[model samples]
Target: MTTTPDDLAALLASVESDERDLVLSTFTHDDAWRLGCLLVELADERDLPVTIDVRKGPQQVFHAAREGTTPDNDSWVQRKVRVVERFGASSYLVGLRARAKGTTFADQHQLPLQEYAAHGGAFPVRVEGVGIVGVVTVSGLAQGDDHALVTEALRSFLGR
Candidate 1:
């Protein structure tokens, strides 16, 4: 399903406060590894060509299953992470809001496109009382699919 600004807003509202808070509480090297492995297994089962990354600040905690992905996917992950880190929201939500406003993140925020993307698949890892601490990202799927994949994985991981 194509995601609109409203849908993206709902997703952000659903995840940003509640889900992110809970998930970040469980954040750790082991949790990141498990989350990465789960994403890999999901992608493998679905025959998806994707790369998964989970990072805290500048430190990458876990990465898994780069299948049929190129260097471009890595770059996308970086860019999308930049968006999540900068905005403290999901990359797809940012993209949808920008589109709904008839603007692009690059043009609207005067940001470099090469360094920041507004596409999907990167979510802020926000703590309950602490705020954003990291990002979880996926690349090599359609924008909505990438967003959904990360969201679903977070839900499953958090047992929500």
Candidate 2:
């Protein structure tokens, strides 16, 4: 089944009781949408320009933009996949992996461009009772803040 953007929010909105608990408990913290919102909020808080990409693959499941976001030749969807792939590869190339059994890879490394190009991103998504299923990636921000934005969003959205 295709997971539409509306599907995610509406599903989250209607969730309740043990059902909600089951869903929220599986995440290590940040989920994709929360991360996206955090990027926006951070952009506002810091007076920065950012474009957040939350994708499932080459396809962008969610894209959030703040004022003054630059349009790079590389679109958000492409960057999301690269971040996930680079992060995933660090495991084999460098013997790195998530400390937690199924939390995430230790965050992949990427070159930070001043304004364009994909910067910091994440690749770990929590699916409630389903456990970690995919990644929640964001680029076009400071590396640390980029990671924090995603993680913080996850924590806030999960209400945990």
Candidate 3:
């Protein structure tokens, strides 16, 4: 079903809450590995065709792709991750805010679609007080589904 404006409003609010509440006390390389693994496990359990990526700053900490995925998934992950890196927010939240203003994210921000995709899936990896130090991203499902999957993994990993 197509999302109504009220649905969009509620979704935007939920995503904002996820970004705010899903904070790590401190993120290490091990934390990235474990979190990334948890995401992959969740996808595998549901037999999802997707790719997962976790990055700390400019460095890739973990990555995985399910059997049905392709190189395009990698491209999409890169684009979504770029959005989180640039804006310090979940990609879906950015897209929703732009939509609420009756504009596309690329047009509103003057960002090229090729490099920065303000789509769902990429979420900022925020520390308790350090702010966004990395990103966790998933690609392959519908944009909103992709966002939800990542948030679900995060909430599980964080025991929230």
Candidate No. with top lDDT? 3
- The TM-score of predicted model 1 comes to 0.85
Q: Which segments of model 1 are wrong by more than 4 Å?
A: 1-23
> Tens digits of per-residue lDDT for model 2 on 66-128?
667666513653544454555442111121122222223333323442322233445455464
lDDT (10s digit) by residue, model 3, range 20-112: 899989889999999999999999899999999999888999999999999999999999998888888999999999998888997899988
Give the least accurate 10-residue stretch of model 3, judged by summed lDDT. 1-10
The numbered model that scores best in TM-score is 3
Per-candidate TM equals 0.85, 0.50, 0.97
Cα lDDT tens digits for candidate 1, 76-148: 9999999888887788878766766777777789999999999989988766677777788999999879988
Local distance difference test scores for all models: 0.81, 0.47, 0.92
In model 2, residue pairs whose N, Cα or C atoms come closer than 3 Å (at least 3 residues apart or on different chains), thus clashing, are 23-128, 30-154, 31-154, 123-135, 124-135
How does model 2 score by TM-score? 0.50
